[model samples]
Target: MKVRVFVTPKKGVLDPQGVVIETGLRQLGFAGADQVRVGKVIDLVVHTDDRDDASARVHAMCKTFLTNPVIEDYTFTLDEAP
Candidate 1:
């Protein structure tokens, strides 16, 4: 199985990188952009065919090492490996 994880700052959390990007966009005349948030995507393969097992393992991975539980939120999807 293949997994893709998305990590994002929780709402109300300060995102300095996102702020910088928003400011830069405004300076470049992209005034319509607002409430900008930045995040990351992680792609990896887990050798499993059972969806339930894969989900549990990935959830644990996210909680233990993939995200900062205090200020970050994560979501993941599983797909058949190509």
Candidate 2:
């Protein structure tokens, strides 16, 4: 099975990295660039017979170990192997 995870800051969380990038863009004459948000994506592949269980495991991994739910949010999608 293949899993794709997307992690991002919550709506109210402040993203300093994004703010720095936005400021840099503005300083570089990209005045139209405003309110930048940064995110991360991770892909995992595993051999599995039960896709449902694999999906649950990946979701748990994100919620428990990969992301901090207070400031970060994550969602994952699972794909069956070919």
Candidate 3:
């Protein structure tokens, strides 16, 4: 199975990278670009036939290593591999 993970900073947490990007956007004439947050997209291949099991394993992976639960939140989607 192919799994996609989206990790992002929690609300109210300070995002220095986001702040810098937003400031740069304003300086470059992108006034409408607001609340810019930089995050990561992780793509993984899990060897599994069961969607539920794959999701469970991916969740565990996120909780154990892929994310910082205190300051970052994550969500994932699963798709069958070709």
Q: Compared with the true structure, what per-residue lDDT tens digits does model 1 show for residues 25-70? A: 9999988989999999999999999999999999999999999999
Evaluated at residue 1, the lDDT of candidate 2 is 84
Residues 2-79, model 3: lDDT tens digits: 999999999999999999999999999987879889888999999998999999999999999999999999999998
TM-score of each: 0.94, 0.83, 0.94
Candidate 3 deviant stretches above 4 angstroms: none
Clashes of each: 0, 0, 0
Candidate 2 regions exceeding 4 Å error are none
TM-score of 3: 0.94
Model 2 residue 11 CA deviation (Å) reads 0.8
Worst 10 residues of 3 by lDDT: 31-40
Question: Each candidate: RMSD to true structure?
Answer: 0.9, 1.7, 0.9
Please provide, for model 2 over 1-82, each residue's C-alpha lDDT reduced to its tens digit, 9 standing for 90 to 100.
8888999999989999899999999899987878898988988885786988887788788888888899999988888856
RMSD of candidate 3 to true structure, Å: 0.9
TM-score-wise, the better of 1 and 2 is: 1
User: lDDT scores for all predictions?
Assistant: 0.95, 0.87, 0.94
Look at candidate 1 and give me any clashing residue pairs. none
Assess candidate 1 and give its lDDT: 0.95
